[model samples]
Target: MTQQSAAATPMSKEMQDCVQACMACHSICEETMSSCLRMGGQAPAQIMGALMDCADITRMCADMMMRRSPLAAEMCAMCARACDLCAEACAAMPDDAQMTRCAEACHRCAESCRAMASAMM
Candidate 1:
């Protein structure tokens, strides 16, 4: 509750990993969204929506961790789900390099966030 207590509590490795993953996912999703749009035909409404959602959630999850919010765990959980959805959407276009990279990042972030959420529980 107090800043002292919060500061005294060291961050766990899993939490740190999740934070890093979320940040990375955020950047990837954002860049991928633009890249997808530029690619034209491949950027369907569903895929675009997934990229945007993934970017938003990853940013939220990272911010929650940085601020040491009590809701960080819940945010991580939500982020994991979003990342999974994004991964699925990206993976649908196996031939596209950008989509493949985004899918991989999403998968990594999803796994890390899932671990972080479980640890919080």
Candidate 2:
């Protein structure tokens, strides 16, 4: 394919970073959610809900980016909001190592997604 062809077009650095961040956030949220569930009474419904929401959104955003969907930008914006909420929930439990890690991942993912969304606009 020629340089100007669609197939020859590479993803911008921000988009690539957002995609990677989304995938990482998905994995972290899933793991954190499972961990919270395993903790039984330690995990509250709100935290669990946030984790689940973050996991699902991140997975969808990553998939959309991978497919080069036209709606990926919107999806990234949604993912950023979800990630921020999830990070806040996780960060509330400061003593837990898993929660802390999940919060950090979520925050980074949110930043990356925000950048991607702005770039796509």
Candidate 3:
């Protein structure tokens, strides 16, 4: 699409990308948490809980964007911050490739969300 056409649109590529990442992160985190649970004591319960929280928030943020909710910008900002912290926590557990991937995904999603939120400002 041409710049003019795209510009006229409310959502930009960055916003779309962020939403996609947020969705992916949500699914991945849920899956990862399940896997961790299956591992029983091997998984950190507190960390898992935090991951679930982050994923839920991330998904909520994406949902707001999909509906073009009035609170989308605020939600995105909050999700971005949550994602960043979650990513950092995941990064600490380098032993699990899933965690690492989730961390990276969250980080990327956070950046995109933040950018989109900034655009709305």
12-79 in candidate 2: lDDT tens per residue?
Answer: 78778888999999999999988887888487788999999999999999988876777888999999
TM-score, cand. 3: 0.85
lDDT of each: 0.89, 0.89, 0.82
lDDT of 3 by residue, 1-121 (tens): 5645544668767778888988998987787788787878476666687688888998899888876776888998998888888888788789999888888888888888899889867
Q: Which consecutive 10 residues in model 1 have the weakest lDDT in total?
A: 3-12
TM-score against truth, every candidate: 0.92, 0.90, 0.85
Better of 2 and 3 by lDDT: 2
Better of 1 and 3 by TM-score: 1
Total colliding residue pairs, candidate 1: 0
lDDT score, candidate 3? 0.82
Model 1 Cα lDDT, one tens digit per residue, 9-50: 877788788889998999998998888777774688899999
Provide the lowest-lDDT 10-residue window in model 3: 1-10
- Winner on TM-score between 2 and 3 is 2
The candidates, ranked best first by TM-score, are 1, 2, 3
TM-score of 1: 0.92
Clashes of each: 0, 0, 0
How many Å off is the CA of 41 in candidate 3? Answer: 4.4
